[model samples]
Target: MRWALVLALTAAYPLIVYFSLGHVEPRYLALLLLVLGGLRWLAGGAQVVQARWVALAALLLAASTALLNTSVPLKLYPVLVNAVLLIVFGLSLVRGPSAAERIARLQEPDLDARGVAYTRRVTQAWCGFFVLNGGIALVTALWASEEAWALYNGLISYVLIGTLMGGEWLLRRHLRARHARLQA
Candidate 1:
């Protein structure tokens, strides 16, 4: 499936860049960026409004990657992405709708006051995660070995995100069930 292929490419991208450095032609990095961006843009056509930011990020990545020297830029892409995420989440906490609220509304437009508060907390959690992840990514790009960078950014970061997401889902489910029982 398309999602499967996208995930495979995403999971493999850092490893490819890390290992291919000095082993393969630099032009290949540009090619890979184009491919990834094109794929995201195409897939983004059907996405919801809040999620459209991802499409924009993909386009930016492709354009910037094409223009920059691949040597360091390729390694720094994840750092750039995490920084963007940190900003987006941090901004949401200030004045506008929380990122978690936007995402929750996608599924529950009439979510209750409790739900809104809960989503805000979830947003805070995500902001914290982004800060931590972005910090590690910054360190990786600046000082870590290639293998360390690739391993943390490529594998560990994804796992941590999944764990956070899964934990949130489980907690939300438990809260929802408890509320339903109370109402009954």
Candidate 2:
């Protein structure tokens, strides 16, 4: 329940900022984000390297927003999220058992060498995705209008993420079927 609330709040953050802008002060929004960050950090987000870095970045953004009394910091949240994700996924490629491999293991504990390689490639693809997504996010935050920022961060980005995940799932299914036929 706690994690669900946190996730929901985080997902709705862009819209929240967009709607609240001009009506509510940016500092108050920053306070809300700071509280959310604290909740996530306390709720075991700090246990993982990726989650911890994301939480820390969010906290820093919130603090900057509060101090500067500007919406720029608040808008930079999505950019930071993409950056943190990129770093985490990219690092996993350098280390053993890439992020996708770790996730694949949850479903298939006895992943073969082929599976490991596939997951590693998937992890690399995610790194590429993060780079492109993060660049767009940075552009939206810096020069785009508030509506454009909200539209991309709130709607378009999620659609793109879903598309990537769905595409990957389809490809994995096809590969699995081909491997099964070959083995048979």
Task: Choose the strongest candidate by lDDT.
Answer: 2
- The lowest-lDDT stretch of 10 consecutive residues in candidate 2 is 44-53
**Against the true structure, candidate 1 has what lDDT?**
0.75
Off by over 4 Å in 2: none
Which of the numbered candidates is closest to the native, going by highest TM-score? 2
User: Where does candidate 1 stray beyond 4 Å?
Assistant: 1-8, 37-70
lDDT, candidate 2, 1-184, per-residue tens:
7678877887899999999999998988998778777767766543365666677888999999999899999999888878988888888899777999999999999999999999999999999999998899899999999999999999999999999999999999999999899999
Could you estimate the TM-score for every candidate? Answer: 0.76, 0.94
Query: How many backbone clashes does every candidate have?
Result: 0, 0
- Model 1 C-alpha lDDT per residue in residues 27-118, reported as the tens digit of each score: 55766766765565556543433235654665566566567645555666677657667777778889757889989999999988898899
Q: lDDT at 151 for candidate 2?
A: 97
